[model samples]
Target: MANEIFICHNCPMTRTMATIGTKWKPIIIYTIGLKQQRFGLIHAKMGLISKKILTEQLKELEEDGIVKREAFREMPPRVEYTLTDKGLELLPILNLLTEWNSRHHQADFK
Candidate 1:
């Protein structure tokens, strides 16, 4: 039974990478975590990602169940992106990765 379960499921790391393997996904997640929900705010926070790429990434994240996109019907139409529960669950892991990178490569960031 255990072997069957293992065979039925993807390796955790592989599954994680499939969801957020790209160089920009984690940064996008972190930016959303910071309450920068609007498209413009996220684009501004990233500073270098082209709008097209950011839009693509956001779409992928939304499809993967890691982010939620809500559109408000109003005069100008406001859209916001927020992390889903699944994405919230990844924050601690992201924080650990950030801390590990900082500890090992402090000079690079400075």
Candidate 2:
């Protein structure tokens, strides 16, 4: 155990961070958490995000078993993003953090 020196080959925290620590992932999670949304809706809420970042974040979340992506075969094709059971579980965590920030750092912010 002493020689382990905290190796991080596929560690859980590393994996969690890899999935949610990016600037876009939490925003994407929060956006989709409100309700299932199409690509445009998420993009509209986060106007500053580029298409490349949105695409990357969605793909990562889907691959990480957090977000679900669905596509419809309409005339122009339709797509939607939603949180999975795992993804939905993150909401309470985010909300708690929000409450904590409000209590502790409200003055630090406006």
Candidate 3:
């Protein structure tokens, strides 16, 4: 008799968490989902996140294929960040999380 041990290499939940499992990633995604495409706009909306950290997060998101960054050449350089299909797919999940938080922590708002 031969005994074989099988191990699951990739877990969907782990992969998903590794992608957007940060204090800022989801908020950044939600802000982008709201149509704020420019860096300044996203930064302004997030108010508390430092520019360095925001830039870093955006870069990571872009590298992970969740966000797309477009740069335009002209007198002033313009760059905009938008959700890729993968990022768009994450919107509903974020929405559900938002709804859950609101329902359970309604008192926090007051």
Task: Provide C-alpha RMSD values for all models, in order.
Answer: 3.7, 2.2, 3.8
Residue-by-residue lDDT tens digits, candidate 2, 6-108: 6565578787887799878888898888598999889999999998889888998999899999999997888899999999999999889778889879777
What's the lDDT for all of these models?
Answer: 0.90, 0.88, 0.89
On residues 5-92, what C-alpha lDDT tens digit does candidate 1 reach at each position?
A: 8965777777888889999999999889946398888999899999999999999999999999999898788889999999988888
Each candidate's TM vs. the true structure? Answer: 0.84, 0.85, 0.85
Question: What does the lDDT come to for candidate 3?
Answer: 0.89
Error of 2 at 43 (Å): 0.6
How far is 21's C-alpha from truth in model 3 (Å)? 0.5
In model 3, where do residues sit more than 4 Å from their true spots?
1-9, 34-36, 107-110
Ranking by TM-score: 2, 3, 1
Deviation in angstroms for 57 in model 3? 0.6
Q: For each candidate, how many residue pairs have backbone atoms clashing (under 3 Å)?
A: 0, 0, 0
Least lDDT summed over 10 consecutive residues: which range in candidate 1? 7-16
Top of the candidates by lDDT? 1
